[model samples]
Target chain A: MKDFPYTESKDTRSGFGAGLHELGKTNPNVVALCADLIGSLKMDAFVKDFPERFFQVGIAEANMMGLAAGLTIGGKIPFTGTFANFSTGRVYDQIRQSIAYSGKNVKICASHAGLTLGEDGATHQILEDIGLMKMLPHMCVINPCDYNQTKAATLAIADYEGPVYLRFGRPVVPNFTPADQQFEIGKGVLLNEGADVSIFATGHLVWKAILAGKLLADKGINAEIINIHTIKPLDARMILESARKTRCVVTAEEHQMNGGLGDSIAQLLAREEPLPLEMVAVNDSFGESGTPDQLMEKYGLNETAIVAAVEKVMARKTK
Target chain B: MAQSTASETHAPEATKSVAELQQIATQVRRDIVRMVHAVNSGHPGGSLGCTELLVSLYFKVMQHTPEPFDMNGIGQDLFFLSNGHISPVFYSVLARSGYFPVSELATFRKLNSRLQGHPATHEHLPGIRIASGSLGQGLSVATGAAQAKKLNGDQSTVFVLMGDGELEEGQIWEAALYAPHHKVDNLMAFVDRNGQQIDGPTDKIGGLGDLRAKFEAFGWRVLETDGNQFETLLATIKEGQGLLGQGVPVMVLMDTQMGFGVDFMMGSHKWHGVAPNDEQLATALKQLEVEKASDY
Candidate 1:
């Protein structure tokens, strides 16, 4: 298998800031609103460059969500930036009524998603965002893998006409994806070609999945790795095709096992193409204060965890 | 652009005298009562309470287009119903002011009807720009619309109405704190100080003490008007509009009685969300009279 290599690591939130700053220069109608976490969200560049279009909504995420919805009424595309917890649960009703249910063009760009948020504890680390956002009918939920992919997803969603939940993380992980890649929503990225198992991963877990692929390769077990970015309109065709080829599946994401990438894939596979499956996700639980690495390892979200899940599913695969 | 929409149909009419506006308000009150009573569901108390404000805004104050309704509302005025439980009044005013067919008022809360129990834009309703059954979100939406208008160099004002009780929601204060800081002068927010909510009197349940002082302290140019009357309230709204584009938002505290027109429903929070029955509907309808326009 050809190794996916990266020389540098970067935070996905910076990618969001970079994309937003570029959008500020390109699309005049693109407006940014932050609920008082400009530095954490890495939105200072956009704020400094496009002060006129930036809205500092203080510590009120609900108002920010509602404001973003209202901004769409006058042909303005509003991008609201906040922590994943604040972005999803705190302001869910605002998002539901104004943005999602109203079909407003608002991009809810959430940073510090999942356990990778690091040290801020369970109160800040939101493990249930994917489920809450994906449940909304008109809302598109996306969780890009790395810095380049995050930036590309940010840029692509600007042209999309509806509410979108673009999830990213605070940790500086491997920036492995192409810098100039065209991000397509609901389309999975194939990182490897193998026959033994299909490794479906998303968000920060994608890099871990790639590492797991390398490990399984050394063990003479061919593994296929696919990056699922959009969790709402899932890439069913790609997932099922990969599953059919591999016969067994392993789904991974830095989210809860209850309502996440794994849950979605499990349902999809059970319905269209039933296969032996194992998931690398946090079983219904809350996160606590720890370094990103510690959290991932403790929560069984690292490469080793994926390998373990693969091994478990391999044993269940039918000959 | 607001002045040029087809005035005779599906658009707000040209400026009318105080008497003529009162007549339209009467017809609107009739529409509000009948629409709610038809479904045996919906809020008529607050709807009837704010009839004068809704009628006055559509007929006299706002420069808006009802025909070929644009969600963007660029270069034209926009109105957001923040107190959306009072949708009875909002829907009545929207239909009578030409946003939709007045006859469609019959489908107020019916399935497959644009006139949802709460104001919703997803129904493809002509005038509604956002969904707002949930309280305390309307002001934020209006503030954003006002800011959008400013960015587009469109001087048209954005109006939003909230019940006084809705102020209890923290989101309202958040928008309250943000608007004046951002210099959102193009927005005009009103509180239907009908002094009642679902449970009881607003002050008794959750005291909204000193609203004029509260808004003034928040850096808004505050105006208190009698919302039950056409002449003075319309004049107060006109004066509020003049304060726009001047670097600060405006807030108006409008005083009106809950279930204002119908005597039996008036002065009680019990009618806050309850619709009138057959006998009550006939009694309520008899209380509202207008010489100019008939009921749909």
Candidate 2:
């Protein structure tokens, strides 16, 4: 296992805010629009610095999406901010027609994704956003793990010419990645190398996978951990290469097991290299109001769950 | 592509008289019926109804270039077809206005054609800035483009034509409120008040009571015009253009029959999306006959 230490915890949304502020200074064409969640989305710095560029589209996600598409007509790269549910579900048709099908360069930045949006319940905590966005032909779906990685992804997507759904969480987790890391879309980050099992994780569950790697190492089991941030245009080459060495895989995410990262990996492995795989994710069920820790525990999305999943997948591995 | 800036002013106004525009509209109506009939599918009622409105904009009112089709029409007046089901009319106007070869009209709704069932930008189709088959989205897109024009310091107008029945979509109301609030003064919107939808008459299905009153309440300068009358619509567009940039978007509630040009297909919602049969097409074309008519 690799020695990955973190000195502080920070919400991924703040990382997005920081990246957006940087883009405001660096890229003249980059513009921001928020749907009545400026403070929640942590877009205060960007809004203050570039008030003219920032559009406060009050509480209308659909209009925000349409305006974002229109802004692209005049060579403006628009980034819309809102919660995950409102971003994907509430304005799905608008995104499909105006942005995705139209092939507009609109960055749909969604915060408070998955069960990490504690106490808001299932209504606000959207587990199907990755699926919803990835299904669109032109949309690139990205879910970064830590604060630094989220910031890097935010800045990188601005240069990408197409619709993108950037998903992050509200909870403050480990800020582990490098501050100046280059974010490459559709590329997986290898955190640790092992021979027994390959652990692929995304979003908030990536830290838990790291902790699980440590636990597995202590128990005489070697685990390879890879951060699968960009869900769509998934890094199949890395996955196949790691799976060939480990012979088994365990996927983890703070989303439903049905259409989340696990499903994506399962489909890839089924086609190219079949292996014994276990998924640590929420089953087909709605979440309830609870603390982040409690909800993660109840939903089987913690380090302990990952460790158990690794053990199970390893046990099923053929010699 | 070179930007078609606002400084390249339009040709002198009133170059074509009402009679000349009416002749072009007759040919456009002929093209709409033929294109829809060739595909054996498309909406013709609203197309015929809005023929004069589109004719007036493309040939007389709007200052746009069709020869060098630029997606970012930075300095030119832009138009979006919100009621995209009436694409036959929009495609005809665009083709006749020299956006593309008129021969391409035969490819409407065919395999691998730029003229999709709805107006789409993905095909790189000239004169189309956005895809808007899905209703209630164009107004917002036009408002966004209008804001972009304002940001670019372009002194040109952004026009969008929508369906009255499409007003039931909540997003239309959302954009309606947003345009005036943001002071999107560069936008001039027109609603095809034909009082019909796909299912039935709009009133029988769901009434949109007092559209002018609704727009006025939402802080818009409302204007009314007879959409099927070429002279009335041309004058109304000129008047609407005069009302722009005073800190309010203009809305033109154009009253039109569902099927205006053809005598037999008029005033009913049955032909909203249904294409005319071969014999019916002959009858409709006969009614829209024009001297020296050129069919693509």
Fraction of native contacts under 8 Å reproduced by each candidate:
0.80, 0.65
Model 1 Cα lDDT, one tens digit per residue, B40-154 = 8899889889999888778876778788888898877788999889898898888888889988988889999998899898889999999998899999999999889888988
Residues B96-181 of candidate 2 have per-residue lDDT tens digits of 99999899999999999999999998898999888888998999899888888877777878889999999999889889999999
- TM-scores of all predicted structures: 0.97, 0.98
DockQ of each: 0.83, 0.76
Worst 10 residues of 2 chain B by lDDT: B1-10
Lowest lDDT block of 10, candidate 1 chain B: B1-10
iRMS value of model 2? 0.8
Per-residue CA lDDT of model 1 for A1-319, tens digit only, reads 7678898999999999999999999999999999889999899999999999999988999999989998888899999999999999999999999999899999999999999888989999999999999989978999998999999999999999999999998999889899988999889999999999999999999999989988998999999999999997999999999999999999999999988999999999999999999999999899999999999999999999999999999999998
How many clashing pairs per prediction, in order? 0, 0
The root-mean-square deviation over C-alpha atoms between each candidate and the true structure, in angstroms, is 2.4, 2.2
**Which residue ranges in model 2 land beyond 4 Å of their true spot?**
B1-14
